[model samples]
Target: MTGRRRWTTDEILGTAAELLRTSDAESFSVRKLAAALGTDSSSLYRHFRNKTELLRAVADRTLEAAMDGYRPPDGWKERLTATALRLREAFGQHPQVAAIWGRYGSGGPGSRLVMEEVLQALRASGLPDEEIPARYHRVVILVTALIASEAGVGALLPEEYEQGMEQFRVAVLGADPDRFPALSHFAREIRPLGVDRRAAFDEIIAAHLAQIEIAIP
Candidate 1:
C-alpha cells in the first residue's frame, strides 16, 4: 500500500474495487480509495481524473475477467445462456462495481467484446441482418438486468438468509388465517426470495431464447 511500492494502474483499480465493495458503493470516494491504498488522493488522481473514471476502470476489469477465457456453448441458445451465467459469476464478486452502468459512457474494450460475441451469436443463429440488432438489444438488456439486479441485492444481503426467512414466515403466519387466507396459505412458499439462483437464471435465459426462436423460422 506504500507509494514506495510504485502502484500500477491495474493494481490501483483492483484495490479501488475492493474498497468500493467494502463500502457498498454508496459513499465511495477517491480520497477513501487512496487511504485504502495507503497513498494520497493526488496519486490516484494522476491515474484517474475522478471517481467516475476510476469506477469505469474497475467495471472494465470485471468485464474483462468475466469474458477472458470464456468459450461459448455450441448452440446459440446455450451460448447466450453460458455468457449470461459467466458474466453473473464474475460480476457477482464485485457486486457494487455495477454503479458504473450507463453513466460510465458506453463501456471500454471488454464490454465491446462481450457485445460483439452476443451479436455474432445472434447472427450465427440465422437471425436476419435486420433482426440481429433488435435481438442483440433484447438479449443484452436481459443479461445486464439480471446480473445487475442480483449483484446489487447480493451486495446488500448478509451471507446467511435462513434465519431471516424463518423470521419473515413467522411474521406472516401471525396474520389471521381467515382475513389473510392467501397470505397464510402461501407463507411457507414465500419464505425467502432466495433459492436455486442458477435454475432461476436458466429459466430466464430459456424464456429469452424461446422468443428468439421466432427469428429462426
Candidate 2:
C-alpha cells in the first residue's frame, strides 16, 4: 500500500482556494479541505492555527497571484494604475478569495509584498514623506473597497445577483431627470461611454490619480 502524500503550503493553499470556489463559504470546513487533499485535518492544522488563519493565508495567496508578472511602470501614476487594474482582474478571477479579503481586510506575507510594491510607487509619486503613511492607507482603501464592492456579488445566487444588478440599473438609469440631473446625464451618455465595468473602473482610477497628481510636489 502507498504511504500518505505530504503537501506543501502552496499545494495546500491552491487546493483550499479551489475548494473555496466550489463550496459554500459559510459551510466550508477543514474536513472538506482535508478530504480534497487526501489528508486529515491534523495536517492542515499544523500549517494553520485554525480555519480563519487558513482563510487569511489563502487571501494572501490570492494577492500573490495578483502581483505575479506585474511590472511597475516608469511613472508613478502609471505604476499605480497598472497595480489597481491588476488587482481588479485578480478579484474578478478569484471571487472567493476576494470575498474573504473584503471581509478580513488584512493580509500576510503576500499582502505585505503587494503593499511594499504599492508603497514604492507612492514614494515615486513625490509625495512628502510625512504624508506617505496616510496616502498609502488611502490608496489601499480606495483600491480594495472598489474591488470588494463589485466582488461582493460573487457569493450570491445567479438569480438574486442579477436582480441586484437590475435594481442598480433601474434605480440609477431610471431616476428622475430633473432631480438627479447628473445621473440622468450619465445615463444618457453611458451607452456610448461604455457602461461596462471597465469604464467605471477607469473613471474611478482616473479620479484617484487626479487627486494624487494634485497633491504631488
Candidate 3:
C-alpha cells in the first residue's frame, strides 16, 4: 500500500492562496483547505497551529511572490517606486490576499523585507532622523489607502459597478459650463479615466516622489 503523501509548508500556503482566489474569506476554513488538498485537517495542523496562522502564512507568501524578481535600483526614488509598484500589482493580482494582509499586519519575513527596503530608501532621502518615522508611515498609509479604495470598488458586482460609473459619467457630462467650467471642459476626458485606479496609483506615486525630491535638498 502507498504511504500517505506529505506536504511542505510552501505547498500548503500556495494551495491555500489558490483556494482563496475563488473562495470568500468568510467561508474558508482548514477543513476546506484540507479537502482541497485531499487530506484531513489533522494533517494540516502539523504545519500550522491553527486556521489563523495558516491564513497569515498564505498572506506572507503572497508578499514574497510580489517581490519575487525584485532587485534594488540605483537611486532611492527608483528603489522606492519599484517596490511600491510591485506591491500594487500584487494586491491587484491577489485581492483576497490583500484583504487578509490588511487585516493582519503580521511581520513575517516578506513584510520585513518591504519595510526594510522602504526605510532604507527613506534614509537615503536625507530626511531628518526624527522625521523618517513619520514619513515612512505616511508613505505606507498613502499607498494602502489608495490601493484599498481600488480594491473596494473591485469587490462590487460587475453590473453594479458599471451602473455607478454610468451615473457618475452622466453627472459629469451634464454639468453646466459656466457653473462648473473645469468639470465641463474636461468631462469627456474624465469619463474614461475617472474610475481608473491604475492611473490614480501612478499619478499619486509620482506626486509623492516629487515631494520627496523637493525635500532631498
Highest-scoring model, lDDT: 2
Q: What is the lDDT of residue 79 in candidate 2?
A: 88
Q: Which regions of candidate 2 are displaced past 4 Å?
A: 165-195
Worst 10 residues of 1 by lDDT: 98-107
What would the per-residue lDDT of candidate 3 be over residues 1-217, giving only the tens digit for each residue? 9988999999899899888877657889999999989999999999999988888888788778778888999888888888888887887776777777777655688888888999999898887778888889988878777765665666556787888888887889999999999999998887443366687788898899789778765
Candidate 1, residues 1-217, lDDT tens digits: the string is 6335568998998888888677755588888888787878897888888777788888888888889988877988778877887788888787788645534633778888789889888987998798889889988887777777676556665744556666676778777898999988887666355556667878988988988897586
Model 1: which residue pairs collide?
Answer: none
Task: Work out how many backbone clashes candidate 2 has.
Answer: 0
* Residues 8-119 of candidate 2: C-alpha lDDT, one tens digit per residue: 9999999988887766557778999999998999988989998888888888888888888878889988888898888888878777778778788556777987799889
Model 3 C-alpha lDDT versus the unseen true structure: 0.81
TM-score of each: 0.86, 0.84, 0.81
lDDT of each: 0.77, 0.82, 0.81
Off by over 4 Å in 1: 1-5, 99-106, 157-167, 177-179
> In angstroms, what RMSD does candidate 3 have relative to the true structure?
3.3
The alpha-carbon lDDT assigned to residue 179 of candidate 2 equals 97
Total clashing pairs for each candidate:
0, 0, 0
Select the stronger candidate by lDDT from 1 and 2: 2
Model 1 lDDT at residue 178: 88
Worst 10 residues of 3 by lDDT: 191-200
Stretches > 4 Å off in candidate 3 = 155-160, 163-194
